[model samples]
Target: MTRQNVSIVLIVVLGALLLAVPALAAALGNPALVGLATRVLIYAIAAASLNLVLGYGGMVSFGHAAFLGVGGYVVGILFHHFRFSEPLFGVIAGSDQLLVVLPAAVLITGILAAGIGALALRTSGVQFIMITLAFAQMLYFFFIALKTYGGDDGLVIRRRSALFDLDMRDDRTFFYVVLGFAVTFFAIYATVIRSRFGLLLGAIRQNESRVAAVGIAPYRYKLAAFVISGMGAGLAGALLANYQRFVSPDMLHWTKSGELMMMVILGGAGTLFGPLFGAAALISLETYLTQWTERWMLILGPVLILIVLFMRGGIAGLIDQLLRRLK
Candidate 1:
């Protein structure tokens, strides 16, 4: 089958599965599973953002989680101290209007990312990775040192951000909100990858010197991709904080960044939907395994090792290969 035909089939199957989830959850009466799925979707968005940089732009950042934390903290600080009443510089804080907050989060993250990416892209290889990681650690410690808003203990969001009188505190409402953002971001990502800039970014990823020779500045393209990636992560963070009604320093940790990378790798890094699949599988496994036994990491470690050894392209790649064989 043609790639377009395959994509259509995949979309149909995925849409059916998503639509069936709530019904299945209701039938099983497993609120936990429903919650887990929601969490998976949120993280999937974050991981997909990471893929834009690491998988598409060939930028291996070890501090992408910093953007997530930054976005979450922006919401938290605005709500906590601003009395959850007034806006920043006359705009109301905790507006919770996804339309308002989502764009704000993306713009904020994009600015931060542009600054960081400009500096980090000056170096490559381990240096680039280490610099990004170091910056992320700095942000993590900064949050830890901020005595206000619970510091290391974290800050609680007393209420969900308001969204047109929508009861965001309702689990089902929150779940749909997250799902909507994930879908929207994924759509945006798809468009980006097909755009002229995305083509240049892909060229830079494959051959920087060649792209430069063709008059395209590799650094500029890469930085742009990095900023877009950060914006996606930031949006995910905003949704996450609303979902949990809390924000913490751990969200900025290097380990969380690594986990995002792992999710992309496990899902088939370069493929559009790989990160989502990877996040769902990994989070689902972690949730189920932890419930089944305390030593969940023990099992997870070996499984990951095996996947790396035997499935280099990840689950998405494997499925694609299988489909090709059937054809």
Candidate 2:
């Protein structure tokens, strides 16, 4: 089969498997399987968001997890006030409805991203990374200081966000709901990559001076992409908070940001579907390894190192190579 045909077959097979997950888990009597799959979808969305700036825009943000934390906290804090029938800041009312909550998370993160990008984008290379990381650390500590919202112990959401008639409490239902969002995001990202803006972003990554010489300011485009990427991370954060029913300062930590970066790099930084593959591979590896040994990170470290050392473009690249060889 040709490459296109092979890719198509692979996608269809992958989709089929995803659709069968809940049934398979039920048959195997392992409901945690659904949860694992749900987590992967959430991470995939977050990792894809990071790819927009990291992969296409050639930006390295060490503090991307701040967006995730912010998004989750938005949901958590809003609901906490709602449960008490108290308005947040004695102004905005808390909402349990998914429609209200998710959009709020996205909008808040977008604003945060815009402010951060406006300043961070002024520098280049390591300075930019450090500035982003600093912003993340600041947010992380800020959350930790919010003693009213469980502080270091974190906050538990008693219930999931309501979405009209949908029963999100059901594992299968929530998984499908998350799947719908993941698929929607993947479609949107794909569309973005095909648009003119995506083309310019790629050009900036390849050659910034040349693009600027042509009278296009790379800053505006980069900032725009950064804001959009943050919004995507925010959306994923909201979904993740809904799935886990908890939010904590750790969500905004540097380590969590590192994890998201690893997902993007491991899956093939610049490729579509790379983040999904990366999230699945990393999460699956962690899941299986932890089941076997407590020191899973020791094993994971070397494995990731080997892949980074030998694999040219990560898992997606490896697959492309195999397909070409088969052809």
Candidate 3:
């Protein structure tokens, strides 16, 4: 099929799914599950952001979760210290004020990404990965040591940030906000992947030496991709803090970073929508499996191994292969 055809089909399918969400929620009669799905969508955005670096830029960052933690903590800390009642510089610091917090989270994450990428882009292969991981660990411990906002125990957001009186505390309202951001980020990512800079980054990923030989600086492109990825993760992190009404150092753990990478790989790296599918599938399976049995990880481990062993291209790649075979 042509790319246009695929795009149309995807748009149609996504529209249908979104339209059906309300009906589905009504049928299930469980607001909590709907809320859970919304959370998955937020993570999908984060995973897609990571894919910009890992899949396209050929930069393997083992500390992507730190961005999310940073975003969440920004929301938590600001509200806790700055008095959740009034706006800072005319903007509120609560969960309902997603507009205010989201940009702040993204900017902060971008700043950190720029600094970390400057050092990390100087290295390559396993060294780059280890350096990123170490930086994340350092931040994790810093948060742990912060005794002001519940520190190791985490801080609870007593109220949702305000957005023109829309109560974000309502599960349905929050779900729609997350869904909106997910779709918006997906569109932005698609545009970025097709832009000139994206093409250069793609080239660097395939052959850094050749890109450098052509007079293009591979490091700059990689750093740009890293900052973009960090911003995406930060957006998800801010939303997550609102969803959970808390922030903790655990969000910055290496395991969380690994999970982001796993989502990218499982969803078919380089595919725009792969991360969304992967996050939804993995998180859903985890949620259901944990409820079914105590040894959830035991079951999950084999499934992941099987996917790596047999489904080499992941779900999106598998779909592509099957479609080609049909043709």
Candidate 4:
């Protein structure tokens, strides 16, 4: 088969496998896999969003985790207020609806990203990375100081948000919900990368001077991409908060941002489905390694380094090469 055919087959197979995960886990009496898969999907969303800016736009945001934390806190705070039957800031009311909370999380995160990107976009190279990290740390500390929402201890989401007739509290159900979002987000990401705006963004990444010389403002495009990426991360954060049943400042830590960055790079930064594969590979590796030994991370570090060293485009790139070999 040609590599293109193999690629098509691989995608179909992946979809089939994702759909069967719940049933497979149930048959094996390993319900934990369902939750694990859900977590993987959520991180995949975040990693994909980061990939948009870092991979295509050449905007390396080292503090992307702050947006995730922002999304989670939005949900957490809203739930808390709703549970207490209290209004937010003595006027705005809380919401337990998934529709309301999810959109709110994405919108709020996008707004924050716009504000931060306005300044961060002005710089480039290492300076951009450092500024992003600083902003993230500041947000992390801000959440830590918000004592009303459990502060450093984090807040528990006792009840999951309402989603029409679906019970999000159920692990399998939640997994499917997340899966749907992941699939939808990937479709949208693919479309965006193929559109005019996406083409322009790539041109800007390759030659910013040329794009600017043509009278096109590169800043606006970059900022737009950044905001969209942040919104996607926010959606992932809300899903993760629901999955973990908790929200904390740790979500916004630099290490979390680093992990997201690693996923994008590891999965093949410029390719569609790279983040999903990266998330699965990293999370699954860490998870299984932990069961084998407490030093799983020690093993994982060298393993990842080896992958980066040998694989041309991370896992996705390696797969393409192998498929071509078969062809």
Candidate 5:
């Protein structure tokens, strides 16, 4: 078979396995495996969103985790208000509907992304990175001081946001919901990467001056990509909050941003499906390593360095090379 055919087949097999996770876990009599799968899927979505900017647009944002926290807080805050029958900001009422909550999270995060991107885009290289980091940290501290939502103690969600007759309380069901989002995001990524805007973003990444020479304003396109990326992360965060039933400032921490970046790089930065594979591999590795020792990062740190040095394209790139050799 051709390389394209092989790739298609591999993706099909992977999707099949993901879809059958609940049943496979049940047959193996290890239900917790589903939860692990769910975590991988959620992070996959977040990491993929980051890849759009970091991998494709060449924008290394250190504050991507801020959207994750924003999404989670939106869900938690709304739930808190819904329970108390109080209006948020004395105007907007709270909602427990996933339909309502998820969109609100996405909208708010997109707006935040646009505002931040406007300023961050004015700088490049390390300046851009530090500015993003600073903005994220500022938001982090703001959340820490917001006592109404448990502040640094975090907010506990007593119930998952309700869907139309869907029993999200069931681990398997929730896993499937998250899986659906992952799949949908992959589809969107596939479409976007082939679209005109995607082409422009790629050109901008290669040479912003060239794109500008072609009469396309790089800032607007970059800002749009940033907003879309943040929205995707927001959706993932909303699902994460529901999955864990908690939200805290830690979700927005720089470490969380680093993990998402790691996932993208480890999986193959520019590849469409790399984030999913990266998240799976990293999470699985972390799980096994932590089981053996609490200082797993000491081992992980070196391993990642080696990958950066040798396997510059990451695990996805490595697999592609092997496939080419076989062909």
Candidate 6:
């Protein structure tokens, strides 16, 4: 078979395995395994969103996790107020419905990203990174001081958001819900990266001056990409909050942004499926390694460094080279 055919087959097989995870875990009576798989999918979504800017648009944002936290807080805050029969901002009523909460999360995060990107895109390189980080830290502190939603203690959810009467409390059902969203996000990411907009964003990444010389506005394109990326991360955060039934200030911490970037790089920055692979690899390593020792990060640190030094493009890149050699 040709290399392309082989890859298609491999992807099909991988999809089948991922789809079977919840069932397999259920059969083995391992809820934790199911939960872990769900977490991986959620993180994959977040990393893929980050990849849109970091990998393709050449925007190094260290505050991407701010969206994640924002999304989670949207759900948490809404639910908290709903539980207490309170109205948000004395205008909008709280909701426990996924339909309402999810879109709100995405919308709010997208707006926040647009505002931040407007300013951050004016600068380049380290300045862009620092500005993004500063914005994210400011959001983090704001959440911590909100006190109404448990503040530093975080918010606890007593029930999952209503999903048209689906039994979201069941682990298997929740896994499927998360998996569906992950697939949808991947589809959207693929479409975005292949579209004309994606091409322009990529060209800007390669040479903003050249793109601008052609009458294209690089700032506008980059800002749109940034907003879309934030929306994706926000959706993932909402799913994560639903999955864990909790939201905390830590979700917006700078380190979480680092983790999302690490996943994108570890998988293969520009590749479509890179974030998924990266999340699986990193999370699996953490899960298995921690069982052996508490210093799993020490081992993971070296592994990441070695991959950067030797792998060049990461796992996806390594696989591509092997396929090329075989062809």
Q: What lDDT would each prediction earn against the true structure?
A: 0.85, 0.94, 0.85, 0.92, 0.93, 0.92
Candidate 4 lDDT, tens digit per residue, 123-187? 98899999999999999999999999999999999888889999887899999999999999999
Worst 10 residues of 4 by lDDT: 303-312
Could you estimate the TM-score for every candidate?
0.94, 0.97, 0.94, 0.97, 0.98, 0.97
Indicate the worst ten consecutive residues by lDDT in candidate 6. Answer: 22-31
Best by lDDT: 2
Q: Which structure among the candidates has the greatest TM-score?
A: 5
After superposing candidate 4, which stretches have Cα over 4 Å from the reference? 1-5
Model 5 spans with C-alpha error above 4 angstroms: none
Q: For candidate 3, lDDT tens digit of each residue in 5-90?
A: 87689778976886567568888786567776887888899999999999888889999999999988988877774564554456
CA error at residue 33 for candidate 6, angstroms: 1.5
lDDT value for model 1:
0.85
TM-score of candidate 6 versus the correct structure, residues matched by position:
0.97
Alpha-carbon shift of residue 246 in model 3 (angstroms): 1.0
**How close to the true structure is residue 303 of candidate 3, measured as C-alpha lDDT?**
84
Superior by lDDT: candidate 5 or candidate 6: 5
- Cα displacement (angstroms), candidate 3, residue 193, comes to 0.4
lDDT of 5 by residue, 243-317 (tens): 999999999999999999999999999788899889999999988898899999999999989988888898889
Clashing pairs in 1: 87-91, 87-92
Candidate 1, residue 195: the lDDT equals: 91
Worst window of 10 by summed lDDT in candidate 2: 307-316
Candidate 2 residue 179 Cα shift, in angstroms, is 0.4
Which lDDT tens digits does candidate 6 get at residues 1-327? 787798888789988999999778879887689989999999999999999999999999999999999999999999988998889888889999999999999999999889999999899999999999999999999999999888999999889998988999998888888898888888878998999999999999999999999998899999999999999999999999999999999999999998899999999998888898999988888899999999988888888789878887877887888888877
Summarize candidate 2's per-residue lDDT along 1-327 as a digit string, tens digits: 777788889989988999999999999999999999999999999999999999988999998999999999999999999999999889999999999999999999999999999999999799999999999999999999999999998899999999889999998999999988888898899999889999999999999999999999999999999999999999999999999999999999999999999999899998888899999999999999999999999988887789778886878898988888887
Model 1, C-alpha of 24: deviation from truth (Å) = 1.5
Please write out the lDDT profile of model 1 over residues 150-268, one tens digit for every residue. 79999988877877777887787777777777787888889999899887878888999999898877887888899989988998888888778899999998989988988999999
